[model samples]
Target: MYTRAEVYSPLQNTAIWLAAWLYSVESTDETVAALTDLGGRHSYGGQGLAALLLDARASADLSSHEPVVRLILWGPGQAAGLHAGSAAAEALGPAGAIVIKAAGGFSHVLVPRYWDDGVEWRWFEEKKRLPEPSWLSPGEADSLLSRATEQAAVLIEAAGGTRSDLPNPRLTVGTLADFYDTPGLPRGVTPRAAKVLARADRVAAIVETVTDRLGDHSYDPQLFALWRHIRTARMAGVADAVQDYRRASIS
Candidate 1:
């Protein structure tokens, strides 16, 4: 796999992820089908949840470089027991990037640059599940994304998973990136999501540079428009159009 780095955006980030998912699935041996299968697990990555799959793919970027961090209980009470994993991807504020995950009646929020800013993700009313190792269908990516976030909030409110609390949630907990990393990859044929992944890295750089230089300014709509253009071009089978994406991202 190629190296990809990114920071989440408040607007249109999901679309960016779908671009990546579309790219990855295309690269899959079966091209968009691998996302539909979890090998036999209660997975959602392969499910056709539309925006759900897109979000999951975006969340997966959170762990692309870092190892999965456990979201063990951070609060008081047995309600805090078990592995609670809610992964948060931070956007550019006046500060730096942040990633927060909460479950197990608790939460863990981390800012890559500042540990002090890191906070625990607390229980919220929701339900999220990891994509299981079962066989998957191509269309499940959207569902998996939606379900994970939904379950994450519920697990927090429910006080983690059904099992007893673990000393470290990361040990038992898994993220979208982690779930996909587990075991062997199912095989077939694929298109190519690499460009999407590549675009993520480039866009991230653009965001950083823009933020550092622009400072608290509303990003030009053209940036978003460019991103949309990239997505459309890729889906339409015009791989070279990424050059247009590169131009838009940099300037």
Candidate 2:
């Protein structure tokens, strides 16, 4: 039960909906509607979602059975098992990626790039071999979300509340809320995974909102320490959600 107002990262929405489609939990129409909403949020000029799916399908040639689609999120300290110095690693360094694994050990990684014009999907070469990402267990995911929730509360309190009066053009309280709204989970998602994702999304939204206003506050030693904790927590929560949803899809 997701509304149009809910916002999702391109990779998050794509992985969830596409996995649902792959797992036979959702129809093509449902997946298309979800992706169409995602496309409307961006300004990319590349191939449409359908065309991109077609290309990916053609490239993977997954004829044996439904493939396993996993969402791999990476950042500065987290490589998500990507080999160092590899093209896929370099491309996924900035944002996250979607890995589609077919039969016979065949797979492809789709990295979404955000440019001044819009967003584009970059596919890793099929010949390139990527390491399997280490996924978090249900207990680990729950613990991460719990810590993130606590850290977010501390951050918001240290920042003088969730309301930000800053005048930043790109990031504002309103925009952050809109950008990180609690995404809707696709059908067949496990209850634990759904709970983790919802909590993760809320924590992420709070972290972003508070981080955006950090510039306005004078550099306090305590605030800086709290900032570091919340940032780490946010990253962990996001990564956990990515892997948890994948597990949910396949389970």
Candidate 3:
């Protein structure tokens, strides 16, 4: 078992959480539209959302190991893969922090975490670079899965976390769509707006590929189950966001 301290160690204060969250967003135009509704018309868009998550995570007062989490979503009614980010400034002070993000596509999945090393967080703004996930074809997916599982086992041994608890499960399309509506979302989400919002599902593919790669690692089943639930729930809020967009379009 990975101690709560290990998972939550890095996120212990405002500055670190803020910096870590900043590194959590997608700044490139390729993934831009998919992440736009993340913070509505907020000045910073996805970057702003990361900052906000850090602030709120601090307010919740959970230890970094016992992190406070949020679910983010885009698209109408949350149509496609689920993702999650965990930020906890309370448990893991500055040097020991953790910030996470995830999305699923191509029947694959990924969840990424950043452990602070005192560097100001920077978004990966690269434009023409796309990573090919582990599972490419039936043959390739199997090979990648084997590699991921083996790597997960090694990581588990190194971290002292259980190998069985690391390999995340495969994601389905419907569950992926519901990833946005988090149980503890930060302020400024307007329910009425998501009803008409529309965004290209291009990012859906990106997330799926990521999740698939992530699933190659070992993960707790409970965590995977939560990912599914939160992933699906975001649609309700997304529905509202969609409606907001439609009204704006009409106006």
TM-scores of all models? 0.22, 0.69, 0.21
How much lDDT does candidate 2 score? 0.54
RMSD of 2: 6.7
lDDT of model 2, residue 25: 69
Checking candidate 2 for backbone clashes, the offending pairs are: none
* Each candidate structure's count of clashing pairs: 63, 0, 61
RMSD of 1: 21.5
Best by lDDT: 2
Residue 77 deviation, candidate 3, in Å?
22
Tens digits of per-residue lDDT for model 2, 4-83: 11113556656767766654567877877776556443322355666766655565433433335666665334445566
- State the lDDT of candidate 3 residue by residue for 48-145, as single tens digits: 44453444333432222211222222222222223222222112221222222222211111122333322233222112212321212223323333
State the displacement of the C-alpha of residue 26, model 2, in Å, after optimal TM-score superposition: 1.9
lDDT agreement of model 1 with the native: 0.28
Best by TM-score: 2
Candidate 1, residues 73-152, lDDT tens digits: the string is: 11111122222352332221212221222233222232222123221111122234332212222223223333333433
In model 1, the Cα lDDT at residue 82 comes to: 24
